[model samples]
Target chain A: MIQLLRTLGHLTVDGVWQVGFATRFLFAMLRHSGPSFARFSLTIRELYFSGVLSLVIIVVSGAFVGMVLGLQGYDTLQRFGSESALGSIVALSLLRELGPVVAALLFASRAGSAVTAEIGLMKATEQLTAMDMMAVNPIARVVAPRFWGGVLSMPLLAAIFSTVGVIGGWFIGVVVIGVDNGTFWSQMANSVDFREDVVNGVVKSFVFGWAVSLIAVFQGYDCTPTAEGVSRAITKTVVYSSLMVLALDFILTSFMYIGK
Target chain B: MNRAILDLWVGAFVALGFAALMFLAMQVANVSEEGTRGETITLRARFEDIGGLKVKAPVKSAGVVVGRVAAIRFDPQTYQAEVEMKVSAAYPFPKDTIASILTSGLLGEQYVGLAAGADSEMLKDGDRIEMTQSALVLEKLIGQFLFNKAAEGGSK
Candidate 1:
């Protein structure tokens, strides 16, 4: 048991260092490439794929989440005779945390896993080896596109999630549950701030995108040239990226609120 | 080749769908307009605490939004939160309107609720609201209730 604990500690330390090294490597690659307008195009393509493509899922999920929040929040607020507070709760929760975090998690599950799997399959097929043999930088070709795509898509997806959530909340809270329309909108408008909460959510989405891409690329790049290895890489990318998004969220929230 | 083309079309459709969703959301959030609609009047309130209060938060009378919270600052002399609110021209306010920092629910968001007085003098744009109330924090209220309950229990 003691020996196992030591091994686990060593592995954790090693993993942390590896993550640090990978981040440095990614930044270094970004810096080395000269005036890469091509990267911007790649980012746009990624934005379309990650942001635009994920709309249906995001809207569907957002609607359900907003409805649930209304149902729960309204019921709770009714006890205090303050059911009008439903708008504020939905808007605050969606804009502040749920919208960005849930969207990122969904993106990681859907697109992040796909990115890892595709790259892993390419590696397994020795296509990456062929690029190296031709003296081509695989990082630029493979890692850059996927990374930029994830980064660009994250904020757009987050925006969609927040919007859908608010609308859903409105439908459930005002229309279905019978909170007054004027009260619901007025409460939402009075409670949420564009600069503080909305901007904060957008900023967090960007960070989430970067983290998601990094994890996906790292796992994909490290995959062994085997079928099982590709599957394992895909699994690890989703699990690790989701955990990282949640961890970073807590850290950012703490930093934002701790001293103030 | 056919499969690839089909995939590309599907991708394009997906992208368009997202764009439409964003457009609709932007409309709902009212992202286009910077200033409030219609004519505006101003009111002021002082509070001990204004948690998560933002500049764009709506200023309301009854349940209808008349304007938005224009600015929030701390008074150097009083060490209290000074909140400036804007009201729309559509609703005429009495001179003796009372403003309170109100919550939506037990543990919910804070907003400024206005109650107009019987006085006939209509408040103009940028006029200060003299009467004000601060937010009632749940934790403090709960603590007070518990302490009171405990004291009563002990006495009994």
Candidate 2:
């Protein structure tokens, strides 16, 4: 009994301490991020590494997801004799929930894990120490650029995902399923409000981007400098950022849909 | 690998991202025409029971959408629901038009249907529609039907 209680206490203290340290580290990173913007090419290079490389997966998955939504939505709506509404259903689902969330999850595994691994390796190799000794702030030179790159690319990737998904839904619903083309398009246009649905979705993606990027950089910077430590940090980056994206998505959706 | 080539790829990526956003705003959503709806005239109507009528619900006439419900307010003194709507200026209506709460399908959204009446004057902005019909509540309808049936059996 005593051993169990001690273990519990130790976990509680460690968790609290980690949260506090992460918060302070975030503030330090922001305070030292001026050079990331001043010398913008560093950020651009990271963006290319993270954003451009991840396009194929995001787009292909978007198309497949959309086609599945179309097929499922058609089967369900056909019961009510309202299959023309398939377009609206698919678009709304993609924009409001699936696009930002799934893209962020894929991003966590692909780009986010890569970022953590790279930073963790840099720490393990003493490059960060060399930079520190050379009178250069490692946070500004390395971490901040990658952080900004992930943040900027996330929303754009989500947007592309949703757009491609919508097109894929259209092709399946209209061409393959034989729903009236005009009705499908018109119903979608009528139902989806620019301000309420589209803009809100963009806002969700932006918040997700900010969160996932912060968690990735923070984990990488805080990991121990060793082979096992770098691998562990990469795992934490994917797991923690995925959970953060899902939890934040639920909170945002509740706030957006409360009045309705 | 080179700086110039990397810059070009990054620029292209940014451009593609913006283009996707543009497609979402214009094609997938109704962003472009939201602002270009042209001139509109506001009108008000009073109802005893508005039912599930909501703001932005379509107002139809002759099986076509002519306007949208703009606002709904409840009056404490008279115990009535006052609904405000915006009608397109191109579709002019007479002063004695009838506004009725309607449902599109069996389990679909509620809207307001306008039926024109013979009158010399056309409705202007801020005009009040006098001939209004309340929405048909399902519970009330069932209750009425049961009561009538019981009454008929009692008479027999």
| lDDT at A68, model 2 | 95
TM-score of each: 0.70, 0.90
Regions of model 2 farther than 4 Å from truth: B34-44, B61-67, B86-97, B114-130, B139-156
- Per-residue lDDT for A82-196 in model 1, tens only? 8887988988898889988999999998888988888899899999889978987777766677777677667877877887888888899999989999888766655555666
Q: Cα deviation of B127 in candidate 1 (Å)? A: 14
Number of the predicted model whose lDDT against the real structure is largest = 2
Fnat scores for every prediction? 0.02, 0.81
The TM-score of chain B in candidate 2 is: 0.86
For candidate 1, write residues B51-78 as lDDT tens digits: 6676666676786666778899999999
Task: Extract clashing residue pairs from model 1.
Answer: A190-B58, B42-B126
The model with the greatest TM-score is 2
Q: How well is candidate 1 docked (DockQ)?
A: 0.12
Q: Pick the candidate with the highest DockQ.
A: 2
Tens digits of per-residue lDDT for model 2 on B9-114? Answer: 8898889889988888887786655422688999999999999999888899976888889999998988999999999898889999999999988778899999
Cα RMSD for candidates in order: 6.7, 2.7
